[model samples]
Target: MITTNIPKLRQFYKIKAILFLSLIISTSSCAQLLQIVEQTPLSDLKLSQLDISNGLKGALDKGVEKQVTKLTAIDGFLQNELVKIVLPEELQIIDTKLRQIGLSSLADEGIKVLNRAAEDAVKEATPIFTDAIKNLTFSDAKNILMGNNTAATTYLESSTSTALYSKFNPVIQNSFEKVGATKVWSNIISKYNKIPFVKKVNPNLTDYTTRKTMDGVFKMIAVEELSIRTTLNSRSTPILKKVFALQDNR
Candidate 1:
């Protein structure tokens, strides 16, 4: 063309520049929208399709098998600070007084025997806990997965605590007798009872130890469940990996 109108040419290029910029912006926005849509369906598909219930049960079984099973062995409770049974509140003073009076060895024996009985009684829990996990419902599993770190353990406690207490109480009583805790505590209590200025104490050790032992078991299981959920390294099973991935992304 004859000498181009310089200003008009400049204006024309500016217009093209604006149009090109707008097209790029539009393309970027469309890509973002497409990504969002693609991700939404994938997430929905994962939640709706995955068999999380069995995976959750499997996780619990692993906890019981690996952690709880250890509590059944000799010195398991005594040696493990995490699950060690200590003196109950009513008996704490008794423990102190017995020690003060040069009966420290007896006091120590009494404490050891309590843990021993707990180790013995814990054997009964594995079967009951297995049965409870086997009966875990999908509703429970989903809520637990989305719940707080200890939610699974809280559910287990709520579902199993009462029945376990009833089952464990009797065994704890028997275990106390078998492990010689009954007689050992009898001696400790007798010695403490004879101490001057001490209030006479007759605690229901069977009930106390039963409750403490259950608490230790639940606490240990919660630790394992938390590890499996939050730490990718602790996902020892494929189901644990797949199921916990939901929590990870959420």
Candidate 2:
């Protein structure tokens, strides 16, 4: 019933083809966002060096704040399998011995107080860690942002471990005393020592627990950093979202 104009129909199809091509280019641009960043000259990067540095620092600070607070919570370290402080190798046999002697409850208390001391000591970490992160150099930031998922965490650990040891050691020692960990462990060791033909042992629990607590803290920070790098939901801040997006498509 209708006669189609071939010329007008050809024009309409040409317009449609042009629009489809534009759409394809736009989609390609989105898909190549990260590739473009990688290929972009360093001087032409959209984000400034300061922006990159500050963004990395901000991410680390958030991770430390969140995970450290969780570490300080009740049952945080004790209940968490990842960072749970268990008796050292020499003491594992002692735990078995205590259970064999039907004093499992006492053994339980000893272990509980150790984790409690770590939890209590972790409250001191935020201030020290904050200072360290705030002082990140521009070089540090660029390397970390471009490095592996846990690169920021690795930087924090390497930069702050010795200082954190000094900071955490005395606190853990005081925490052990405050929470009766020293007393409980003393009882445990005394009872174990009383067992005939057992080798005598005296361990520096302060050093041991401090090292373990720092390891746990770093471990948790690494987890948070990796989550932020790989999981969109973990990017809670604007900068975190934007900065981590570079690595997202990679």
Candidate 3:
């Protein structure tokens, strides 16, 4: 009985082989499917790289918008303790003496003027920072994304420090004049010197504020960088999510 159906059995086996070959051909020839497989590693790398670059750029932009811009505003530095300019080391004694003699308001005004000078100086920061961001190479971008929490800040400092100093110094000098910081300090110091027992103190406040304001700007940038690198919630955009997701896996 089995021998009588041998030809039919042969036909069934042939059909099965045909189906298997067809499946292989379809799988191999499907462009979309094959493309997906080909992109597995490359797409991941590209996506991760892009996310990191965008995240860093976003953080810097936000810092400039939120923190730096405020510092450039009228009372930005005067109001914020974190970046407020204080009397220089040599002038601290004069400040203390002024405050002690019922001249607290005068002393406070002196302090405010220093901060105001800083605020005025910060108006020049965006261009320097933008140049730094624009110059970021692919290697720098990768390092910033995958390196430590302050990687982007470090890159900024390295890339922009010399240029920033060159840029900030003049602006700070001008700001000192524009905000009347020079006159305010002169008044405060004059009052202090007029006190019977006190020696005169005149310090280069413009230089001090310039350096301090630069430090403040960098400090704010570092804060934003750390937030994005350490806090999951800081990855606000889709690219940030995907890039940081891969980072989490690693």
Candidate number achieving the greatest lDDT relative to the actual structure? 2
lDDT of each: 0.84, 0.85, 0.75
Residue pairs with backbone atoms closer than 3 Å in model 3 (clashes): none
Model 1 steric clash pairs:
none
Write the residue-wise lDDT of candidate 2 on 45-100 in tens digits: 46666777778888998898888789999998999999999989977888899899
> What's the CA error at residue 221 for candidate 1, in Å?
0.3
Q: How far is candidate 2 from the true structure (C-alpha RMSD, Å)?
A: 9.9
Q: How well does candidate 1 score on lDDT at residue 209?
A: 90
> Candidate 1 at 179: error in angstroms?
1.0
Per-residue lDDT of candidate 1, residues 1-250 (tens digit): 6787999999999999999989877778977876565457436747442468878888888888888988989988999999899897766888787777788899899889889988988888988888888888877887788789988889889989988899899999998889888898887778888888889987778888999999989988998998998789888877788888887877
Best by TM-score: 2
Q: What is the TM-score of each candidate against the true structure?
A: 0.80, 0.81, 0.75
lDDT of 3 by residue, 85-159 (tens): 787677789878987888999888878877877777677778888977876665576666667777778888887
